[model samples]
Target: MEISTRRLKLLAILGYFLTGITGGVIIYGSEKMIVATKTPILIFMVWSGLVLVIVSLIGIYGVIKINFGYTVLSSFALVVVSITLINHLMYAIIKDRSEVESDRKVLKLWNRHMLMGRAMHKIQDRLDCCGIYGFQDYILNDKQVPVSCVSEELVSYIYKQLGCKEASLREYLFSRNFIIFSEFTSLLLNMITAVAGFKLCSRIDRGI
Candidate 1:
C-alpha cells in the first residue's frame, strides 16, 4: 500500500504537534528542579525552557489550524529557541563536569539562598549523603554537617559518606541532556511540518 501526499503531510503535522506538547511539558515541569536549587543558572535555564514551551505551544496551535502565516512565524521562533537551548545545555554540561567545582557552586548557592540550604539538607536525609563534597564541605564553610547525614542503622554514630554533589551533578546533567535531546527532536519535527506547510501553501497559491 502507498500513502498519499496529503496523508503524509497530516502525519507529519501530528508528529510536530505531539513533539511540541512533549517539549512544553518537559520545559514547564522543570519548575520543581528550579525551586529545589534556586540558583541563578537554574533560574535562567528554566526561563529559557519556559520560553521554548510557550513558542512550542504557539507552533502546535498554528499547525493544528493550518495557518500558513502563524506556522511560518512559529517555526522561525522554534529555530531560534532550539539553538539557544543547545547552547545553554552545552555550557551547563561543561560547567558542571567537575565534582569539586559543582560542590563549590552548590555551596555558594546555598549561602546565597537559604532555601537551597534547607533543600540540600532534605536531599541529604533522603539520599543518605553528606555535604556537597563531604563533611569537609561543612567544615570549610564553617558549618557543621546536618544530622541527616547520619545512618539510620547507627544514629548514635557519626557516619560520613560521599557528598551529595556527585549524585546531584549526575541528576542535573541527565536532565540537561534530556532537555537538549527533546529540543533537538522538536526542532526536526517542526522543520518537517513547516516544510510541508510551506509546500501546501504554495500549492494553494498556484491553485493546484
Candidate 2:
C-alpha cells in the first residue's frame, strides 16, 4: 500500500511537470508565430494552457494531501482540457479552410488603395516578397514595384520573383499546422494523465 501511494504521488508530480512544459511551449510558440492578434485558436490555446497548469497543480496537491475530492476535481479538469482541445482543433480546421478561400478577396482589398497599399508594402517588406503573384502584378495593376520586393543585396536577377501571397500563405499554414499538431499531442497526453489521476483517486479512496 505504501509503495502504491508513493507511485501515485510520483505520477501526479510527473503530470504536473509534463503539463507545465507543454503549456509553456504552446504559449511560447504562439507568441513567436506571426498569427493575427487575439485569433480564436491562439486565445483558446492560451486558455487551455492555463487550465492545464491549474489542473496539474490540483493533481499535485491532491496527491500530496491524499484528498479524494481534490483528486476527483483534477480528473474533471483533465476532461475539460480534452474537450477544449477537441473544440479548438475543429475550429482551427474550419477557420483555416475559410481563410484560404477568402485570401484572394482579402488581397484584393489590400491592393485597393493607398492605405491598404501601405499595409501590403509592410507585409512585403517583412516577408521579403513582391506583389500578389510576382513583380508582374505591379505592372498589371499600373503600380510601381516597391523597394520592399528587392533583396538586401539588390540581386537584379531574382528581384521580385517571390510573391507575397505565397509567403504569407506559407507562414499562416505553418503556424496553423503547428498549433493543430500541438493540440492533438496535448489531447493524447491529457487522456493518459486523466486515467492515471482516476486510478490515483481510487487508490486514495480505498485508503491505500
The residue-by-residue lDDT of candidate 2 on 153-176, one tens digit each, is 656655667776677677667778
Cα error, candidate 2, residue 39 (Å): 3.9
Best by lDDT: 2
Question: TM-score of model 2 relative to the true fold?
Answer: 0.78
Q: Which tens-of-lDDT digit does each residue in 1-208 have in candidate 1?
A: 7555577457646755665575666556566655443345556656665665565566556656666666667656656665676676677666655455456656664565344456466666544667766767777876666677666785555755667777567656655665556656656665666565556555434544
As for candidate 1, its clashing pairs are none
Alpha-carbon runs more than 4 Å astray in model 1: 1-5, 35-45, 89-101, 109-128, 135-145, 150-160
Instruction: Provide the lowest-lDDT 10-residue window in model 2.
Output: 32-41
TM-score of 1: 0.66
RMSD after CA superposition, every candidate: 4.7, 3.4
